[model samples]
Target: MQESWRDEVSLLPEELKEILDITAKHNRWRKYETINLIASENTMSPLATSAYMSDMMHRYAEGKPFKRYYQGTRYVDEIEVRVMKLMGELLRADYVDPRPISGTTANASVFRVLGKCGSKAVIAPVQAGAHVSHTKFGTLGALCIEHIEMPYDPDQMNIDVDHAVKLIEEVKPSFVVLGASVYLFPHPVREIADAAHSVNAKLVYDAAHVLGLITGKRWRNPLDHGADLLTASTHKTFPGPQGGIIATRDGQLYKPISRAVFPYFVSNHHLHRLPALAVTAVEMKHFGEAYADQIVRNARALAEALAAEGFKVLGEHLGYTRSHQVVLDVRKQGGGAKAAQLLEEANIIVNKNLLPYDPPDAIKDPSGLRLGVQEMTRYGMKEDNMKDIARFMRRVLIDGEDPRKIAEEVKAYRREYTKVHYCFDVNTLEDGKLYLLY
Candidate 1:
């Protein structure tokens, strides 16, 4: 009987149908039910989402905006120009390239532009929160560059500024990267920039995790602090589509990075994301300060709550975190991998991470869990919500409550905060809403 129904639908591939079904289920579960805390992920606004689905998705306009190899992309050209301009204004930089397909691609372009084959670079050690793309096993290795690890301060949970300065002066790297995937606090950009410049080294800040915070004016701007270039993913804390941007205040470095993005790194560059990115840029320009401030507040609040619940939250001496992320040492409760899985069973999504003390091999089963509050804050969650989240986590990891039961409660709790905030309310447009212009 089931075979007969399947035969009737033979025009569509069964595998494709199953794939769509799983995707739909995942969408519902992730968007509606789970308490997602993955530091590197976020959901775009409804307006942004609408703009992401467009005719541009099917087309390719290779090369720079007006210098495309393909034809019939005049509108696409205009959008590209506008997006680049918007990004430059948002990040307060002289140049912006919205061409890299991802943050890693942006890093790759930088590695290519700044470093040739067999060049040398300095990066934060993996245990100190370096993203994989910055390491020897990633983009740097692929580009044939020798990567030297900067010294890290376990007490501060960041790069040791004094030791790093000394290392940079000694090794004299081609470039020094100053950002992280599991970032908790602000990097010593200004200090490191000074040291790198003293050695004739270019400073590239991978602001992938804290770009939104910087744009929102809650964190320091690397460009202002002497960074030569900044690479970031638009989707993380920036609240845009999944794309990468390369920005710089140094006009001389712009063209080289631009060339690297085109013939070397990306071709089409995913034109569909341009309009969505523009919308997010406009949103950040207007509401970013408030949103960024709240994200940090929520993060610190979450860290404090988790610490009170007996979780060995990191960076206590540094006031927990200044960004949207909170890191917890989950080793006592059966390590990061087990704790992450246990929390996931309760719909509390998080990622296992390596702490400063973890061995290199601990990457597969690290001793830390990274939690982010930016997405939750966007969904109207506040400091109080952070407290509730910590309680849910305690139930799973500390109290050892039944995960399925806690998951039901989490779903119910999540129902109250479905609407997105800190953006223009399209719903209000229906009623012809207006406000006084101060």
Candidate 2:
């Protein structure tokens, strides 16, 4: 560590000191204590963090690798190409653009590439947990884009394919975005793509939350289903660093997409950090299948356990989740934000999400809490782990109703699960310091 950095981090008011101290403590705790269920968060490998906090984030090499707008990109060129190769192989893409900066930018790049102006597109409503990158800010200042919502069967809360087909026929959009952050079932991508193709609209899948599952074949592959492009965040289920990826099957579309990203949507790009993504891609190639499989198993197990404990987990009503996420309709327990706050008090981390067809007016405190299996799966939890976690929920929300006591129980539970375990020589930290092994 740098000497100046030590002093810089230490130079804070006593109150601020206490806050930063605990925040650092929680980083260690997240490395050490409690279960992590947030679907969108995960523990990146130490090497990946090393790539960021240690070196790469500071390097601001402008423009593309090799052909930079500035100079001294000799090594950065190699790094970017290598990262692109790893990502292509991992995603099975004909071409890969690793410089979209985030999933939103990736989608924005897709939009910019597929249209000139006044182009139509289809997506799930954001209230249904679709990302804003596709349905919100991504289009706010877009290329004269028109946003259309995916049809959903209100009675079933799943995609209303018949209605979607009818709308695709009506709009004949330039692109159709097949994605939803919260909808738990596998979308019939091939079916959706077929519908879009009949109207000559390009198909793009925003597999932001479920890419890891798809990579493992645990979820449907948009590529096989005729998607022209796939975009996702590296952190969510890929469990890598925080960034985005864009992949496409058409060689013809690659340069236009690259052109859209360069000199337009993104400028001067972070050339040096591509190696961090390179390292993550390498790691994913090795453990993705196993990690993905474990995540799905954990989701189903947790869902069944939660349902048996009397929580209204949504998936089981039709088919249990085929992915890592599960939704608890917590309206019966309390409003979602309130339920989430209660869970957080007990050292359980989850987020409030809107249920299908929830009113737009109930924005802040929707009626659902979203959970995922990726982080718990990292701590070596599985089917049996769900039983204990569900019991913990039942105790606080159903029986004892004392969140303080639940916190104690949660801590006790954390101790049982995270005790002295290592993968590739990494374990969660218990004290203020991080250690490779204990």
Candidate 3:
């Protein structure tokens, strides 16, 4: 006797049900269950998340503020103007364009405004932290720009200022890009800017990873240090909804950059993020200093603890890190790929990274692991929590504990620190309500 189809089936299709179930589970795991250490990721505050889900998401307001090509965009213009003003005030820049959708898009806009196809630019080596956007394979290639690698000093985990200055002079490129994805120390922006200017080259600093730290006064502001332009993604340490901004102290570059942003890089500009970005900007204005300080403290603490736990933490001579990240040389623990996989199995998330000595092809299985403490710090984890996290990693990698058992312990530890801090809150939501976007 076959059962009725109604008795055996859900109201929704099985495929849709499975997708919804998987999404819910993923959200539960990533948000409330696992310890996230990815360097390029962060959680938005509840207030900011609320702003991210507006009717603006369904609308479009092409072109610049007060000059849109579409109708019904007066409010969108206001939001964009407010967001730009907030960003400019936060970064101390004369002009800010909050249009580009990602840091790479911001870079592309800069590339378009600075030079045409087949132009040359000097950029940091990938090992020293230059983002892919600055490389020939990313935005540069798309723009038909030639990429000249900057001289990197691996011991300091920064650029070789003397050699870089010489390279900039010798290459005399149209622009010189400063900043890195794996940045531990601040670049020699003033010195490089001087050299770039001497060579008639512009300096574009990609502050995607450390934008929050810079705003919070924990790191040097490149614009203040003589960079002509700066680009950043609002997510990472900035803790905003995903978006990119281009800021400059030079007002003369405004028109070119604005034109490049609209017709070249973006259309409509994702109006939904504008209000959320404004919320985050306000949050940074109020709590960024304390938040950035805690992130750096936690990163250093985690690096120290990991080193004590027999992990080969990088930049030990430079006090581990000045930013929110702590890199590990995982060669001793079976290389970065294996170590990252094992850590993930234990519910400790991190990413494999290329060491300074690694070949470019080793990207598939690099020799280092990149761990960030910014998101964890936002979740109210402190220096002591960093020690516990290091212990978990030690147990998984050194003691050879079963990953499944460690994952259980991880879930328990994570349960204690679920609230997001460093932002304004009305506290109007119900208890146990999931406010996180991921």
Give the Cα error of residue 98 in candidate 3, in Å. Answer: 0.4
Q: List the residue pairs that clash in candidate 1.
A: none
lDDT of 1 by residue, 1-438 (tens): 999897877767889889989999999899999988999998888777777888888899999877889998999999889998999998888799998999999999988989988889999999889999998889999999998999999888888999999999999999999999888888999999999999999999999999999999999998999999999999988999999999998788898888889899898999899988988999899989999999999999999999998899998988999999999999899999999999999999999999889999999899999999999999999999999999999999999999999999999999998887888877656553332111
Report model 3's TM-score to 2 decimal places: 0.95
Per-residue lDDT, model 2, residue 363, is 65
Task: List, residue by residue over 1-438, the lDDT tens digit for candidate 3.
Answer: 245665655567889889989999999999998999999999999889888988889898888888889999999899899998999998998899999999989999999889778889999888777788998888898889998999998888889999999999988999999988998889999999999999888999999999999999999999998999999999999999998999998878877998898898798788899989998999999999999999989999999999999998889988999999999998878889999999899999999999888989899899999999999999999999999999999999889999989999999999999999998764866775544343
Name the lDDT value of residue 243 in candidate 3. Answer: 86
Q: lDDT at 218 for candidate 3?
A: 97
lDDT of each: 0.91, 0.76, 0.91
| Residue pairs clashing, model 2 | 31-428
Arranged by TM-score, best first: 3, 1, 2
Clashing pairs in 3: 129-180, 129-181
The alpha-carbon root-mean-square deviation between model 3 and the true structure, to one decimal in Å, is: 3.7
